[model samples]
Target chain A: MNTDTSRREEHWQRTRKLMFITLTIWFIFSFVVHWFAAPLNAMAPDFFGWPFGFYMAAQGSEIIFVVTLFWFVRAQHAIDKDCGFTEED
Target chain B: MAIIKGDFIDNLPKVYLMYTGGFLGFVLLMAIFEQMGMGSDTIGILFVAFTIAIYAGIGWLSRTMAVDAYYVAGRQVPAVFNGMATAADWMSGASFVAMAGGIYFGGHGYLAFVVGWTGGYILVASLMAPYLRKFGCYTVPDFIGTRYGGNLPRFLGVVILAVASFTYVTAQINATGTIASRALQIPFEVGVWFGLSGILLCSMLGGMRAVTWTQVAQYIVLIIAYLVPVIWMSNKQGFGMIPQLVYGDAVQRITELELLHGMGTLDPVAGAKAGLKALSVPFAAAGDSWQFVTLVFCMMTGTASLPHILMRYFTTPSVKAARQSVAWSLLFIFFLYFTAPALATFTKLQILDPNLATGIIGKSIADVQALDWIQKWSNVGFLQIIDANADGILQLNEFFMRGDIVVLATPEIAGLPYVISGLVAAGGMAAAMSTADGLLLAIANALSHDLYYKIIDPKADTKHRLLVARGLLLVIGAGAAIVASMKLTSILGAVAWAFDFAASGLFVPIVLGIWWKRANRQGAIAAMIGGFGVGTWYLYMIKWGGMDIWFGINDLRFAIIGMPVSLFLMVVVSLMTEEPDAETQAMVDEIRIPTGETVLKAAH
Candidate 1:
């Protein structure tokens, strides 16, 4: 029981660390990029015809969000397996 | 007993795949009927009726008396299908109907809604979904009641759920009414009843079992409807097949056109009539970056906290599935979110560019009014063209179109066949009805399960409990429809308020309940009451009571004030109060790990 509890604590710590990292990336993409969107758009001529700020706000952020979610799932699953915390199927 | 047999559950993928193919084929048949000279009205009615009939059929087939099936669909939903259902549920009338219009008018600022909403699932997947699933409660309130060990917190949970979901559902019903009225040429007031009846037919019988399957079907229809016109418009405009990737040029062109038409300078007549301004300019419609950031924050937090959305994860088969399901939900939703900007840009191009076949700018008023699509939409009061200048030529300032009609009118605007219009109408109805079904179920289930069964009468058997739930579903749904008919608020405005209320009241309590073991019942109660109360007070004051807007937080983003209060009170109060007993702490630890069976399974 003690080992089990310690294992659960370790698993949660790892999971929480991963979650914070993912959310940091999420925040940067969602808010930080959009906050600087105007400057990004001004630099559009250098980076293809697409307005980088507008594209990120409109399309690019959504794609990253999707990828981030899937990646989080895979990473969390791996943590669960490593900690012997995978649920019985 | 539920009708969902083991074999049937195993074949969900195959079954839904075939259903999608069959639905597309049906749309094709409608297109062929259009070629055969069928009236557009008849085609529209056929599309609406056929899709509703399928939902009603699924509701009938999946009708269940078992408590587990009724509340959580036997907890057997696969991750992918649940994700699709959630996407359908999340994409309400505000999303399918008004979002593109918002993007068109508000420009880059409104993408806040899109970003915040999708980003919310990240919070759900990491902080909430799997933990709640492992806790194994049927309703969100069940988690609150169990975790907090009291009825007050549970009662407050139900109240918050009802307030938020009821407000949200009315907006959806309003959207359904708007779509149905246009499609069937009925009055908006009467169309609401039609929409409500269809919503009832799907959720009243089988509960979650019915709603889950029907929502999956709705997702397929809505995505197809949403994608077809954008793709068609893209190809027609020589932008190639992939509109999502190719629309940057169109956005740039739209920016140029806005300047050329003096839209950047905002005509008083255009501003007063339709609120039209620069379409592609960043931060033009949202007033400034502060409002944009706050709006995104409110929407994202709201997305994580909404009871109906959180309930979707409870239907998944296991904790693992719940975590994965949030990703699927975001992915399916991403399909439409990524396309909305493209649709907005392409439609604006069609209106502004005189070279395009659908462009009406600088055209003779008589000629533009004679256009079939304009005539139809104007007849419904969604579109209006007047020779205000009396020059006989329709200037851009003389044209007025409601943002609500943008998506529905896109097919017609791009000069697509009438069949596509009908399909889009069906899609809009699917989006509205699916969301309404979920909200109605969420409200009804909270009332019956959390309030009545758990608090009012614990002795009530499963049959009695479910009956009360179904009865509440009928009552609450009709009540929402009545409120919707009054048109008290714009669909998007009401949705924004719903999110604010949910975010302020529920987000802190629920998140802390899982993560913070010291979070006692006092803290939970304080957070719920303090957050919700302050938010409501702020909204009432700013919106009606003539209160000053504090720190630039508008009525719509009142949660900005409430959420911080809730968090502050929760942490402070939790520290001031005694920590929860060891058993509850153990329960939290157990929920943190995904290896065990659901803790509350036997209790239910």
Candidate 2:
């Protein structure tokens, strides 16, 4: 019984690690991308005719958000399987 | 259970075909009306009637007497459809009509609204949805009641939920009035009643069951309504059909115009209230960057904590389905959001281009009044062509357009015919009504399920509970309608305040409740009171008391202060007191695992 409890605790720790990494990426895409947009725009006024920072803020960050979420979902599922927390069919 | 669940999925194609056929037939009929030269007012009325009829028909078909069906659609909804409905429910009038308009007026700073709102779903899918599903509750307050092992926490949850949800619902009702008046060519006061009846008809029919199916249909209407004008405008402007990829040229041109005019700089004679005439600011500028980050924090956290949105997850079939549903919702929502900036860019091009504006740069307002679209919209007070300098010709600074007008006026701005304008108005109505129905149900459920059934009549049967839920829905719906009809000018500002309140008051407690075993009833109550109190007080002081900033944070973004304070109180209070008992700890363990089934834990 004690071993079972310890195993569960270990599984939760792995899950938390995944959460930490994903949240860091989420923060960077949401805040840092927008924060540096001006410098990028000034560096290149037109990236394929889009003001560089305007393109990143308006469209680029949103595209990255969709990708980030899907990656998190896939990674979390793998962790769940390894931890033996996958639901039985 | 498996067979029953499969039945809805099996019939989905048939349902899709029937709805599509009916909608196409209505469009054909409208096209014929256009050939007959029907007046714009008549055409607008016909558009409203046709769309409302389809929603009303769906409401009647899905009506149910069972409590399970009324509250959570019997927990049988397939994920993809629920995702579509959630998208429609989540994208309110602000997203549909005002976001592009806000971006149009506020420039890059406004993109924070879009990024903040969509990014919040990351938190939702990761932390809240699956566990809430595993808890297998009917409403958020229901979870609070059982998790805390008492009435006080549950009652307090209801109070906070009602305050947040009611503020949101009133704003949605105001949006409904604006769309109805624009579509039917009536006064906004009369339009409020027309909009209220449509909302009540669908929601009162079958509670969540009616609302869920109706929202699916509303989603189709709104997305089509949103895309058509943008596609047309893109092709007309030579961006081709893929406006999302090629709108950069338009932004470049708009930038050139802004630099030439120095428009965003305030006009001293008109005072600072005249507002931005150009977009010259850089990113990472200290004041604006902090404002942007705080607003995003508030919006994202607020999105995860909103009771109306979270309730949609409870209707899905399993914990995996709940997780899948959030991803699908983002996909559906991105279709509109990605296109919004494009819409703003193209519309700005039309406003700036000499050929589209027609009259010479120095021509009189009278000369520009000859332009049909300008003449029509100005009559409705949506677009104002002010010649502030009393010059006969129109200057870039002379035109002042509101944010709400940007989406609704896009078709007209692009020189589309009357029928397309009517369709855009219908889409706006769909966005507003779908959100209003979800909010009304969230409030009604808090009162009926949490307050009445749990506290007032614990032994009440399922049938009795359903009756009380429907009754409360009508009462709350009427009250929101009355507030909306007052034609308050600050409706949008009020909606922003509600988001700050929800983020501050609900986000910390709800997240810690699920993740931390040490989170006790006293901690949650203290966090709710402390967080909500600080948030509301800050809002009142700055908005009414006339302060510019509080402790260096703007009043509009007070959640930055309120949230951390609440988190501190929750952690400190929980450590000072006893942890949850053994059974409660067991309940949290049960929620943490992703079991295939969503069986309810027995009550405390």
Candidate 3:
């Protein structure tokens, strides 16, 4: 019983940690980039003809979001397997 | 016969692959017919009829009387297919038809919708989808009711789901009406009936099973319809096949064109009409960054809380699949979101650049009005030219077009073949009808499963329950159609309000029900009523009663206020009241792991 409780705690901690990291990245790309869009547009060079902030808003953030989701899935899958918590499908 | 008997259900990938091939072949045949001098209107009608027929056929194939299949598609959908279906379910007429138009008009401020919506899938994957699946509820209300262990929370869940989803479904049906009116040359009022029947034909038969399979097919058609014209336009403009990357140049070109057209300059005659902003400019139409940020936040939370979207996860095969399915959903949705800005840039370029063959802004009014595409769209009241200055040529200010026509009219605007126009209209119908199907199902299922079966009569048999669900689906779908014909609001506005309502009311309770072990029934009920009531009240006050804008949050983002209120009340109430029982806490812990059988299913 003790081991089971510890395992659940460890699994949850790892999962929560991963979720935090993923969400932090999500927030940065989703909000932080857009919030600083004006300065980014002025400071950074054109990216394949797009201003930097516009690229992030229109294309770059979406790409990063997709990558972050896939990364979370793989990482969470590993955590589940390591914790012996994967579903028996 | 053998394939229909069982093999078809087993080989989803194979069947869908062949279906895609068959659909493309049909489109090719239509193209040949156009080449052979088929009438454009006939071709348009055929395209709409054919796609709806295919959806109906799929509905027939997947039709089921079984409780599980009707409610959750027997919980056997693979992650990838569920992702496709969810993509179709998520991308309504707003995303498919009006999104590019929004980007074109609102500039960078509107990318909030794209970013917030896709970013929402991240929330779903991490916080909601897997746990909800593990809880194993047929509807969002099912989860709320079971977790809180009462009928009041369940009833509140049903009410919120109905209101939000009904508002959303009406928008989708309105979108379908717009497409149908254009395609069939029918009145918008009559066209909504066409849209409603197509929606009901699929969902009223097989329920979620029908909706899931038909949505997958619709996703394919909509993505193809969206991509074909944009790619063709890009290649025509010497951008090659990779328009998503190359279209940045078109945005730059449009910015130059805006300057050339005297974007910020004042001319007394055109000053009233100069609402066009530079394409790449940030916070131009939004007035400030705060409004943009608040709008993004509202849409993100709203995306997470939408009942029809969350219900898609319940159809996946397992909890693991649910998590992966969200990722897949985002990926499928990404195809359209990433392309929308490019589509907006290119379509605007087509209109504004006087050097292009498709350019209309500087063209003679008679010539522009004589164009077949212009005449057709104008006849439907979607496009107009006033020549406000009595100038012979059409100025930028003289042109008036509805955003809803942007995607549907893209092929015509780009001077692509009429066949492509037919294809785009069909795709628009698919987008609208698929979403309408899902929303109607979500509303009806909550009524039948949560309100009727769980609350009114727990002893009701499965057959009777499904009968009630199907019957209610018919009634509710028709009600929505009637409301849609009334045109209560613009498609995007109603959709935004729907999201705000869902986020304000449902987000707190659902998230807390998962993560917070001590969330009592009192907290849950308080959160739902308090949040929803606050959102509705704020919306009414701001939109009609002339209240001042709080924190620069507009009527579209009333959730910005309601969500915080709900969160505060929920935490305080949960802590003040008795904690949930051990069984409920254990169920929460079990859902978190995703390894055990579904708790609610086992209990029932």
Candidate 4:
């Protein structure tokens, strides 16, 4: 994997800021939202007769993580390119 | 260049042959009895007995004595075989059982375990392993001492290694015990003893040679144990398609039942009869917004910190080999990790309601697994329900949230023969024992490699150094066995804090050390000690003794606060100090060069 040095550097600070932002979003959906929602939705919606809270708490994080890693990998790669160490093998 | 001298060693045929013979022997015996309808408990006992026999057999076969044979298999393991051992080391009790449980309990937040576990290898390959291999040391502290030119840095590394390894081992022991009790119907203490004995045999008698092959065998058992249930679940569903078996009828039936229950129309146990409603909502709520940032940061960093994972590079012959090994490990790991979600959905469906399809369990066929355990587990609240309206049976909404049952439950859901249950039990024990041994051995090696070999006696020759490592392995193994006896949280829960501790401390300095020419002894030492100190400190304040409220927030999120501070102090101090001398710079140059010749040169 070639590091595309010609790739323009986005703001170094800007990159960190965006990661921080996305990371924040990741957490809310994970620990905070699920923790509070579990008790609140006790016996709530029945999708296919399944509790919504159960699905999210058990299965939801996987999707978010896929997205999170997708974002993180791309973002870090871009930063690496800008910083000039793009030789990814 | 190493590009030409690279070689493949193939002794695994002997090992794999042994593995196949053992597994096949068990499968045949278990299947015959199972088709005849043996009870679950008998199968469970068989499972425990079989594992003890196989582990002991391997120990006797290896007959490894000295530390070299024990530790790093004398650093003679072929890459592919070592990769297999490392994969087993990395998985442990927490990974095999607890990961599924976390998904069972926390859902998606637990996804980080997969990402962090796999992704950490990337950092290790790219950032640390190769160079460390060039340094050619036996322990992390040795590498630190040589690189930084100080006893202070070496001491710090040893401390960090011990603390991380000990805490992590606790969870592995804990999880193994849980699996043992579930499979064997024994008390948790008995199971803990089962786990401790395996480690004692491998670490105390066999050393790394015995430990390494044992781990490789354990990996096979674990993978098979996990998959057997999936295969059975799939087969029982017909054509063995897991997604269909899991998600096929379950979604519709559950949704309809839940909506009916919610509207007060469906029977509490059977789910509402009103057409199954669908419950689908996105997780897009904002607040003080959610704490997504910290979780990701913690995981990303944690991936970088774990000691067991980092230690694998020491076994590789070169830096490139180290990098390649990481890629290999992830590729192997994904084989199991990819199956998790499907397992989650399928198990949820299999157990969606109290009474699963009677046709399957009631069939006039053989191998009936008494799900009395399911009701028993549910009674303990590991499994549960609402009985929303008090119907005699269970409804879809009754599926309870438990953080521990998923892996243990896999065999039950698949309706595997009791002998298979025994195999799965053995597998779970394997995961727990291998992980515990790895951590214990690392702690032991630090005592010898870092303390006695490098610091106290540079004068000590190879024989003396070997003796020291063997002695330390015994001491550490006994100490850890004592802890295993006590029992603790599930492996994942106990180790989760360790990950947070590692992420903040071990990840940064190690990563920085590889790339930064300006990373002086002062900066490197400061980064390691500071990163470990502050990381441990944050977890200590928040997680230890259960007193974790910092400024009104839980401590897991704040663990990474130390990472940035460590990074800062590292850079600031490096800039404030004199640059590395010519000898040090030359050493770095040699490590960076991708040639076996240079390595040979350095050896001379």
C-alpha lDDT score of every prediction, in listed order: 0.88, 0.80, 0.87, 0.61
Q: Model 3 segments beyond 4 Å from truth? A: B1-5, B266-287
Question: How does chain A of every candidate compare to the true chain A by TM-score?
Answer: 0.92, 0.87, 0.95, 0.63
In terms of docking quality, model 3 is medium
Off by more than 4 A, model 1? A45-47, B1-3, B270-287, B386-393
Q: Please report the candidate that would top lDDT against the real structure.
A: 1
lDDT by residue (tens digit), candidate 1, B1-604: 3335668888888888899999989999998899999999999999999999999989888988999999999888999999999999999998899999888767888888888988888889988999999999989999999999989999999999999999999999999998888788899999999999999999998999999999999999999999999999999999999999888778778766666766645443443344323233432222366776788889999999999999999998888999999999999999999998889889988988888778887777888988988897777566777676588986656677777789988988888899999999999999999999999999999999999999999999988999999999999988999899999988889999999999999999999999899999999999999999999999999999999999899977999999999999999999999999999998998899887778897437
Q: Which candidate, 1 or 2, has the higher DockQ?
A: 1
True contacts kept of each: 0.61, 0.38, 0.67, 0.05
Better of 2 and 3 by TM-score: 3
| Candidate 3, position B23, lDDT | 84
Better of 3 and 4 by DockQ: 3
TM-score of chain B of each: 0.96, 0.94, 0.96, 0.84
Interface RMSD of each: 2.1, 3.0, 2.0, 8.4
Worst 10 residues of 4 chain B by lDDT: B278-287
DockQ of each: 0.63, 0.49, 0.67, 0.08
For residues B1-604, write the lDDT of model 3, one tens digit per residue. Answer: 3443465657988888999999899889999999999999999999999999999888887888888888898888899999999999999999999999888777888888888888988888888999999888999999999999889999998999999999999999999998898799999899999999999999988999889999999999999899999999999999999899888778778777877765656232432222323223322222356766788888889999999999999988888899999999999999999999999889888988999989887889999998988898777566667766786987665677776678888898899999999999988899999999999999999999889888889899878998999999999999999899998898899999999999999999999899889888999999999999999999999989999988878888999989998998899999999999988898889999978778877324
User: For residues A27-82, what per-residue lDDT tens digits would candidate 3 score against the true structure?
Assistant: 88878878887778777646778878878888898999899999999999999999
Point out where model 4 deviates above 4 Å: A1-89, B1-9, B36-39, B63-69, B242-293, B353-371, B378-401, B461-464, B544-553, B597-604
Writing each residue's lDDT as its tens digit, candidate 2 over B374-472 gives 777767665666667776777666665567788888877777777888888888899999999999999998899899998999899877888899899
Rank the models by TM-score, top first. 1, 3, 2, 4
Of 1 and 2, the candidate ranking higher by TM-score: 1
